[model samples]
Target: MADEGTSTKPVRPSMGSMRSSSFLQDHQQYRPPNKPENHYGIDTVVEDIQASQISSPRQISPFNGIPSSENPPKIVESGVTHEFSHPNCTPAPGSRTDRLVATLFYRSSAPRISNAIPSPQRVPSPPRAPHSPKISALDADIPPTMAPSSSLETFPLEPPSSEPEPLDHLYGSHISPMCITSFLHLMSTFPLPPNSPSPTSAHRCLKLSAAHENHPEVVELTLSPAPSADYLSLADLRKHELIYRFEQEWNVDVALRADTLWRRYPRLVVFDMDSTLITQEVIDLLAATITDPPDLAARVADITHRAMLGELEFDSAFRERVKLLTGLSGEIFTQLRQVLEVTNGVRPLLRALKKLGVKTAVLSGGFLPLTSWLAGELGIDYAHANEVVIDEATGRLTGEVKGRIVGKERKKELLLEIAEKEGIDLQQVVAVGDGANDLLMMEAAGLGVAWNAKPRVQMEAGARLNGESLLDLLHLFGFTEEEIQQLVA
Candidate 1:
């Protein structure tokens, strides 16, 4: 059962390497007292924002996978009792700096176990097949994520839309007549790798309200695996092939998921801050302050890229990078705020979620200073990120991080904690990120969208949206162009 020279030693976390009374006091809510099995935990938020001494420690899952009973998470509710005094910096004035911490509390997540790598399909893709018989709203034999087809609710079942969603974000009113073509045969011949027989069927109801007469429109697809198949595994494989076939080949974006009513209505959407919400990686930005060592910023950014690709363990990489920023003034974070640029389509996306009564949060692995600032500007309700130790008198960083670093496992825990408090089911939540660590939480959500992610992440994530604007995510939620206009209005 063991390989030669393989060791089973538990590597201590880099976050634990820093020793200081201040860090210890600021980091207990995340540090659990004991490890237990099958127990659930919660991340409490003490809503007074100041980077004040109020933060709870978060846990990281040691192994890969979505959170389950096996790796039970534990959290301690250390009330808002302390204060972190750092000078404030605002990129755009009038942004709210409320408490946005997802004090995560979950055991390790369980990684997906695959029998084989998803094989590539035939070179020349199959021509678009004829549209299959659309499933009626009243049918019980529908996709895995939908409400049981057997339910007897008196309300009329809203059937899936057969039309394509508009791409208004890119094209204004110049109408292109040839963009909306049916692509249903792609899934009717489902479970793509190895050229296998269809073990499941998928469909979508697209009714976009926006106008992109000249641009490509989005379409939705729901999957239903046969009795003997593994729903999640099957869906993952199907998703991979759909993307492999269209995402790069013709520049057409794909969004696949288990067809469910929840897709039509989501209450909470969580985003990763650094690259997902903003264009700059905050850590690399901080690293730019280092001039003694030439090209330190580039070197750190490379490591950052590698870590996101799942090449290096994020925890260790985080420590190595943070260690390089030792002796830098805390004021640099404030000054760096001026250069932070929000990603394309973030403003409209957040505004749409808000108008539709959906809650949003930013669970960043980067430091708190920028995370809090971005959250304030976008009106995100909750934001959680690692805090850097600052000397109260000198206003400079000590090259030490306070509280636990929010790694893969930690991010998943934060997602679960937020869903539990909001009374939102895991299936109704959406997690979006572009890194290896984000995979854990992404897999945990009802829908995991890899937005212009690395090759590995794009393949492993639940679904992907490589569109020009983050606003395209609305289509995945089954929103029609008409509905999109009303929601963001």
Candidate 2:
């Protein structure tokens, strides 16, 4: 009787239903579109076109419990006249037919989606492809802007494309066709930066040909067809890949000589006795040694200053300065030599050049007595300075110079003559000095380096080494770091 009562009562369906009526009832539940068992119709919402323009195809995947018998992707071909053919698309609740049709309108006649024509859209658009296009020799001739024809031969692996490729696939993204053509035209003018290097030079080339300010470590190698046989400046050569750029600070492009310029120059370099070898106004130094006439010394010094700066003619300036010191003593040479200070970097540079077999020479406009003493001290090889005309009886200045002045033209003639006598080519010569008088000598040599020179000399000379020690000339000669080490050691 108790078991029968428990089963028969139906339990009055209970207070649980009263407390959770909405959760148990199916009235407010959502039924999924194609799955009757799944009460919620969460996937039944229709997707409306945001804009009336054609858009890229959307790929759809099946929702769980939706029948796989239905094909979600409806592929419509361009110009082939596709008909709505979804076999399982039943009519929506309000529609008489199952087809959700979209009318095909002509681009010229249809209302545009926006002010600008969005790039052409197609059904079943392709996924993104690789960066560089694989172009065959035949395909290279084909215009990049044209669509690949609907033939299997066009894109070998891709089957005869059922519809024409979206114009975006043939051309590129939303950019105008005219803009693309302009871009290609511009690219044709200059070679692309990436392909500028030579293949063979790139392989074995450990060194770069040029220097760029931004990339201090990496050498820049610019390769083009070898230049035609014609003369060109360094700038011209750089334009045509004939010369490479070197660091301005490091190489100091003053002169380019034969490979052995350091080896064959003057063994005995002779500088002028006055301003050539020493800073003391030579005539003034002579005056200082002879008498304590500071005023006459200052006047002679001013004349030399004008001459060195190219203000006065060399002959006129020489005559005036010499006339001022007409009656000095021969003993002045000894005093001047003792007091003279050699120019900076002379010792160090001479030592470096001596190691490389360059003997120093000093040709001077001043008296020989002081120069000869300097020759022995600095190990100079040759000394060609003026001889003071002394009274043979008294050993006093006779108010006259003994030899021809070592002026501009004479200096040049002497440089070439000395080069020939030393068995060195003129091209292997390196001249260094700091005056307008030195300009002719500098031009006569292979590498004329103006050392802390006046502006006029620097402008006329081949290379100028200003505000730097003379030892910097070693770098100009292409000395390797290791070679410099051995030389210095």
Candidate 3:
């Protein structure tokens, strides 16, 4: 594969019926004391009462819904707002007296004003009536220093926008909006475990920060509330839970992980062969070569499943299964490789990875003859597995491992060896496997992806891809749709 690693506020409570008697009583509580220093030339409260009392039955004020008393300095009469008969009411619009009284009026009348304009968390958060008025009050309280001379008319009272705080969990590396959002909604439906909920200010928020998030090829985003500990980090547990959802509900055939960085660029990729790289288990196929005990094939297949499930140890299972093939013909090895079905999307993925110059390897617990052959066919750079001994003269299976069995531990060692030889850090290596034995190496790599792995492995791997095609792996590395096409093409 020519795939190169690619890149990836709460508001205050509203003052309900702000002009209600309760509010006025509270306002009087905090209002400037009636001391000499508090006595300004104009008294808005007294003037408001006087204006209401003086109004005649037939008199129609220019300010219809706006009460004359609510006007701080003077009320508009006959459309002559410019003429103030009282010398004390001639202060400029931004005067402290004007600001103080007008600001109070602006806030107290929110129930009426907000009904005219609904302010949702204008950007990401939904607008709730309880918080909407509080937002307006904040807007009205412009710092006097930041206000202009005609602050009443030119004040920056437009609601200051608040952004979604990124969830502690950050996600990136996706193909499109539909690809990412559907995946997210599916995972979010997963029931969170009983972590004693720690009430924090940053719940239900998110941020989009990927350089190419909206690009047809890549999507990036940051969400909050991730697990802090690295050991069985909440990430791994979530992956386990996500795997359950993938298999059960929602025909979603893909796995989407929320990670700020799944090691943005991986220099090498390693895979396990049996159920991962190919569809048929080589051992089960080899067992089929035996015609005796009619149920021999069935027995070997069961053992293989248990071994992969981690119920039976790999070495013992491999030996027990191989012993059953004591007299198999050598020619079948070549024949087995011929009929091996590559998992969906493997060809294009390998071709893309090769083009990107990422080293690829196969670390198998199966026989080496088929392992190496598969690696060569797929253009993989390295191969390691157990080699079975055969009788030279008869050209048939001897049913014995020639060297140290390349079991779970050996697979991990080989992975580290390959990465070390290439001068790459473990973080730049990706391990893909689907068996209990694959867990060690998967844990050892920077990003361990469970490719349709067993339950145990799925529960522990760093990331899991539930899709049928490995081609989506390209998307995992943050490749754009166009770039993937060019590489595969």
Candidate 4:
């Protein structure tokens, strides 16, 4: 044989497209049994659709020239089931379903299929034309991706400029700010300073006639200034000095925030019946009615005074005092009622309160007989007090309290209960008292007035009326001279 060099060139397959069936038949031996029954029917249909897409003329693989032994992938009617394993082509490890899904998706995507297409040559695409002048300036300003897809127009996100709104448009100049005005009203117990000018030039003085001929001489001083930031504090300071000076010198009782207070017009006015609404302590009077034993009367009076001054507890002192009246005739109550002296300003004050449709109540630690009589006489709306047990056989007091004692706490409870019954706010209540037992009820009220109270009570009270007349309280609620005259009329 002639010596010849062995051909070294590798033969390339003809550059012709292979039929889809022939390509799939080549890998038939590698096909697995039908997919598990659990596999979704929709997945199988999706696989078939992808296979049809990949079989198109534009999607032929460029590496089809490679022999099956050279790690060619196995193609099924659905798609490539498995990629051939070789030193350079290691298949990704996954469940059979995952592999099938991935293969289906890979062949279905147009871009992926185009990239995998076996193209002999690539041609460059033509450059895009520039936008025409007929297009809107706004359209030219927007990028192609962001431009509106349809003919629908778009608006700018914000206005190019803003103008200030006219003040008249927002709020009419005729409008005024919201406000609450309080007026301090003062009335004299005596006629001193009959023509005195108001403490401040901004304030005015209104003279008021006595509610009755027998009532004390009275006048009204109205303090109304433009509202200020520190109006309450300044008013309090001014009123405090005004009260101290007039009360000390001219015997005037000053009432602050009276105007606003009168508007509320307290629905209830609770009085401590003993010393507040009346000049006498009913219990002391009862004890004094026992002339057969002077020492017992003195002892009861001493205990009562101590209790009122906060020395002894009112309940215990009251029990001790009532115990001494055991053998006293119940008929004495009638005589005591006859002698009971109404406090100087009480009748006039009650008259005004009643005229205003305000409810009056007497909360007493003394016996109910006296309180009931007083309440009836003054047309009081309510009365609560301790009941003195009586021996019906003898027509005399048994000296034992019959029911719950009406102490300081009970007084407060009754006040609250009454307010609730009347459907009024506690802020619309006025409590007046003169002793320690009256403090709690007074404290519970919106306005606690200590009327010639003990040192402790006067110190804690919201307002104090030291003059002889309780009618001074009317001024504190902003009752004007004309209003008082109208009320009296």
User: All models: lDDT?
Assistant: 0.64, 0.50, 0.63, 0.61
Which 10 residues in a row give candidate 1 its minimum summed lDDT? 99-108
Q: Give a tens-digit lDDT track for model 1, residues 1-489.
A: 789899888987776656533433446566455744222223222222333343355764453544443443343245543333222222137542211100000000111111221112213223333333332223222332334334447323664322222332132221112212223444344334333323332333344324434232444433333222333354554455553543322335454444446767789899998889987788998888789798889989999999998999998999889888888888887898789988898998899999889999999999998899889988999999999899898887787888889999999999999999999988889999999989999989988888878888778777666645787688776665667767677
Q: Considering every candidate listed, which one attains the maximal TM-score?
A: 1
All models, RMSD in angstroms: 35.3, 30.0, 30.4, 40.0
* Model 1 C-alpha RMSD to native: 35.3
- Assess every candidate by TM-score: 0.58, 0.48, 0.55, 0.52
Model 3: number of backbone collisions: 16
lDDT of 2 by residue, 1-489 (tens): 576546554555556635522333335555446744423233222222332234368665444443333434343455464434433334347743211110011111111111121122223234434333342222122233334454435544532212222332233222223323332332234332342222111101111112322211111121122222234332233223111121111221223222232433344343443443555556666655544465777777777778888888776677667767766766777766668877766676677778878756776666667778888887777776666687877877777776787677777777777777888776677677777887888777765666656768756666555532454555555443345556666
Against the true structure, candidate 1 has what lDDT? Answer: 0.64
lDDT of 4 at 289: 72
Misplaced by over 4 Å in model 4 are 1-201, 206-264
What is the descending TM-score order? 1, 3, 4, 2
Residue-level lDDT of model 3, residues 338-439, one tens digit each, is: 689999888998999888889999999888889988888889999998888889999998888787898999888898889889999887888999999999
